[model samples]
Target: MAKQVAENIQTVLRRLQEGDLLPVYLLTGEENYYIDVLSDFFENKVVDEVSRSFDQTVLYGRDVNMDSVVGMAKRYPVLGPRQLVLVKEAQDIRDWEPLMSYLDKPAPTTVLVFCYRHKKMDKRTRLFQQLKKTGEVFDYQRIYESQLPQWITDYVESSGYTILPGCALLLAESLGNNLSLIANELSKIFAVLGEKGAVTASVVERVTGISKEYNVFELQTAIGRRDVVKCNRIVNYFAANPKSNPIQMVLPTLYSYLVRLMIYIQLPDKSDAATALGVNPFFIKEYANAAGNFTLGKLASCIGYLNEADLRSKGIRNAGTVTDGEILKELVFKIIH
Candidate 1:
């Protein structure tokens, strides 16, 4: 499923290169990566620079209504081969009658692109069905957290760089599911590596300024092993550097770790643990040991402690002015005991 979705975007790029242009493109999706790619292609590539000033009409959904959008699309290009009308953040558009009517017979000289980010267009609407018949309509699905490592690997290779599976997993676990930020961070790494070089874990750490040893993953490991000293060391670092290690972010990682640990405890089969947990096989033994230290009931209690910490961090049910570091310290104490 991931392969097919990835390929679909590639096919669109391939088609664009071949000059097989669609009259209108509806790029609405949960993942803004592909939507941004397609929108950028049209903005910078589809319209030549010389005529772009005259032919390209960029409008935001908040500023313009369907009437204005249809008005701009229906106009003939003065200088360019085609008029490119791009509507960014098109999810703000509510009324679609004027655009729907125009799509009934869209202008041949116009290429309309809609970048509707982080949302799905209602397929039940007449406008959606009409656009499907008359133009390109793509709904990019959100890539899950478990699928990020492979996605990172594919993205790196596509950009003429090589990364090991473990390094990719590290990136995936650290960055979570923010594809835009991940892409930006990867760009920084690639820029430093020059035309082509192997992306090592050390290179990633140094280039991205991510202190792997002091990160939330290490904290999770310490907590899992019931290493009170190690856990406190990391927690103290996190508390001092609240800007980087915000409690909101730290809480989520700890919560996810405990939940995964709990799931690991319930799994009857241990051979396929890595596959089940979407993690590297090398870490399975570590998790196993941690799982031994933390029973299902203990894990549940830890999660509850984490929830309480989150509420306190947000000033909900917090009896006094509790510092983030103090809240974290209390939570860790509860989990460890």
Candidate 2:
């Protein structure tokens, strides 16, 4: 399923570049990054600059209805071979019946694109089913946390620059799974580094202002090695900068790391552990060592601590006036002890 979604995006882009344009595109998904990219491509790439003035139409779903959209799509181009009709925020369109009917026999001379964001069309619905058969549906789901590092590397390489694995890991750990933000930050770094130099941890820190030594990645390493001093130091640093390192982000990342460690402890064959954990082979050694340091029982207890910390961060059942730093400090002590 994952492989197919990734390939679908590439295939769509390739088709667009090669001029094998689809008449109708249903771009709906939880992730808006790909939807924006592909929809922008159709808006800019489909019509030539000179012809777009007459042949291109951009509408907002909140401002227009299905009948009006269909009426415009049925019209012929003024001075070009085809016309481009793009609808942004298509999820706001209340009536899908008319659009589905139009999609059944779409105009051959028009390229219609629906940029539906933040949600997907129901497969069980007649609209989705018919569109699946007639037009192209690019369902852009959010990439998993495990797939993020590779995505960062691929995004960097595609931009005509190289990034080290450690640099990618730092970006992933600091930025979490927000691809849009990551892409923006990488663009800033690329602007400085240009296409020739490699993006290192220093470059990431210099450009993005994320510290290399004091981050979730290093905190995990410190906990895995049972280095109480280092753990406290990183926790203190995070506590000092609550906005940058919120207890909300810290707890989930620590919980995920421990959960993966617990899974590693159970696997009989450790050879394919990296694949199982959805982590890079380069960081598998850290997980292996952490698994050795902490037993399944300890990991389970650590998860419980994480849950408590999460609740405290949300002010649920958290008595008195405890700062986020205090919560993290206490959570790290519990985990390491």
Best by TM-score: 2
Q: Cα lDDT of model 1 overall?
A: 0.86
Off by over 4 Å in 1: 1-4, 280-282
Q: What is candidate 2's lDDT per residue for 1-337, written digit by digit as tens?
A: 3345455667778888899987888898888888888988998899999999999999999999999999999999999999999999999999877887788788999999899887777889888888777778888789888788888887777667898877788899889888889989998998999657799888888989999989998999999999999999999999999898877777778888899999999999999998999888998988888877898898889988888888888888777599889989998998899
Best by lDDT: 2
TM-scores of the models, in the order given: 0.88, 0.92
Reference-based TM-score, model 1: 0.88
**Residue pairs of candidate 2 with colliding backbone atoms:** none
